[model samples]
Target chain A: GESVGLHLPTLSVQEGDNSIINCAYSNSASDYFIWYKQESGKGPQFIIDIRSNMDKRQGQRVTVLLNKTVKHLSLQIAATQPGDSAVYFCAENEGSSNTGKLIFGQGTTLQVKP
Target chain B: GAGVSQSPSNKVTEKGKDVELRCDPISGHTALYWYRQSLGQGLEFLIYFQGNSAPDKSGLPSDRFSAERTGGSVSTLTIQRTQQEDSAVYLCASSSMAGGSYEQYFGPGTRLTVT
Candidate 1:
């Protein structure tokens, strides 16, 4: 019954603009979260990750915000570029499980318009 | 410096045939994982292996699916009597449990098509 899901199936953004993708997770025991980007015909690439202890984590051009209260997670991309267009996924790991298995969300298609 | 690698970039097999997918994890990584990605869907966890511990077979979809990791390095996922619904991209990933980073580095994936 535990699952991760995205708020939007597709999100379009203008070049140079900022993009925000939202996700909602049903598991309260999830302590670790990760955001991944997948280009067409390629494997999912690690973008950023956040632990339950931290509310936010930042990477080069991306940031992941985790709201434990609402069981919500979001990925923010600054200065969205054509290269940023890809399907993004949010995944979570149950803290109590030592196996480190991850449950992934459906995915959000981020489309950048020039 | 090399990352995870999977073999036979793609495979097409007839229904009811058996297929084996291979994965090579990064050097020094003690954790290995297998996932399935259906078209337009997120990655589905299949199984995991850590050190010499028994694999966590909880994620395996059915008895027809089985995997083995040799010497804590190379891994092979075998699907017996595949069905059309088994068509998907199989991804392999590895992470270092030493640091507790849990960040899994993924391979390019083997696209399996059950015809």
Candidate 2:
């Protein structure tokens, strides 16, 4: 089981505002991390990923920050849009295991008010 | 299929009945996976398949749940004597290889409702 957990279960932000979601992971062996967005009645879509070697990675309007010392990871969305209203999940892939199995967090629901 | 595809977008069945969910992976994806999401919970890994080889079913909750991949393209997840607790959305994903943990495409998922 993955110790990855979100600090907030639900978040509400106004249109064009920034949204930040935080996560904590317990497994230090995990080398790969990913964030996914899931809409109602749909599967999760890959958003961004980061490796343990790096502290931050940016893609599109999203940024992922990893703090190995604190075992924390965060996803920051710049200018959060109404379409960004969905559940976001943080996942970890253990490098040592070499298995493709991903340990996923419960998820944080982001509700953007348009 | 261009991406992973699952059958019966939604299913409603009575308790004690059996159900089968299907998943069709991409053209050449060799690593297939099954997961279940209940309510507001995260996805729970159920099983993993690699080509025509054996599958890793350690994640299966019990023997009541079983899955099989045929000819390395399509797969089926069968549940026997289903209970109300089995109600949830079942998702399927496929990657390039079993060892490649990189980006995996997911299917729309099958929403199973047990009454």
Candidate 3:
């Protein structure tokens, strides 16, 4: 069985500040990880993804760091803005079936204060 | 290009009633997945479809839940005798099999409420 969980249920950050959301996964076999952002009344949008072979990947304003040793994943947002406020979720692909079914963490609500 | 789409964005039914939700995957996508999201909770895997092969229904929570993919494009998820606990947002996602690890595009989702 695989379980993905977040350290904090919510995170509040001042505008223009850096925000980091953490997650831990229990399955060692999980190889691929993804970060998603879900705004109110919308579906989860793909933010970024990282393979087990890689330790870190960066997007325009976000970065995902994977630590396989401890089975941990993190998403970092730079210069957070009000629009960046949303629930962030981390998901892992078990890779056993290859159907790309992902197990998602509960989620961390990131609130950006102006 | 259009993203994945789900019909009946909001559905309301009484308990003991049956409901069917629809999903239209992106054109040319080979994989489709159904997930349930409860209020303030994460996505729960429901069923998965790949091409014309037999679907992987390992995630279906109970016998009352079933889904089918027709002609490798559209999918329908049916729930029998719905309960109040069955209320949730049903999300559908699809991905192409390019390179074996494609990103899934999600639909707006169908909100099912059982009164």
B-chain TM-score, every candidate?
0.98, 0.94, 0.98
**Per-residue alpha-carbon lDDT of candidate 1 for residues B20-56, written as tens digits (9 for 90 to 100):** 9999999999999999999999998999999999998
- Candidate numbers sorted by TM-score from highest down: 3, 1, 2
- Candidate 1 vs 2: which has more TM-score: 1
**TM-score, each model?**
0.97, 0.95, 0.98
Candidate 1's C-alpha runs over 4 A off are: none
Predicted complex 3: DockQ: 0.79
The CAPRI quality class of candidate 1 comes to medium
Q: What does the lDDT read for residue B111 in candidate 1?
A: 99
Residues B14-45 of candidate 3 have per-residue lDDT tens digits of: 99999999999999999999999999999999
Query: Per-residue lDDT tens digits of candidate 3, residues A64-88?
Result: 9999999999999999999999999
| Candidate 2: residue A114 Cα off by (Å) | 2.2
Candidate No. with top DockQ: 1
What is the Cα-based lDDT of residue A17 in candidate 2?
A: 92
DockQ of each model vs. true complex: 0.80, 0.68, 0.79
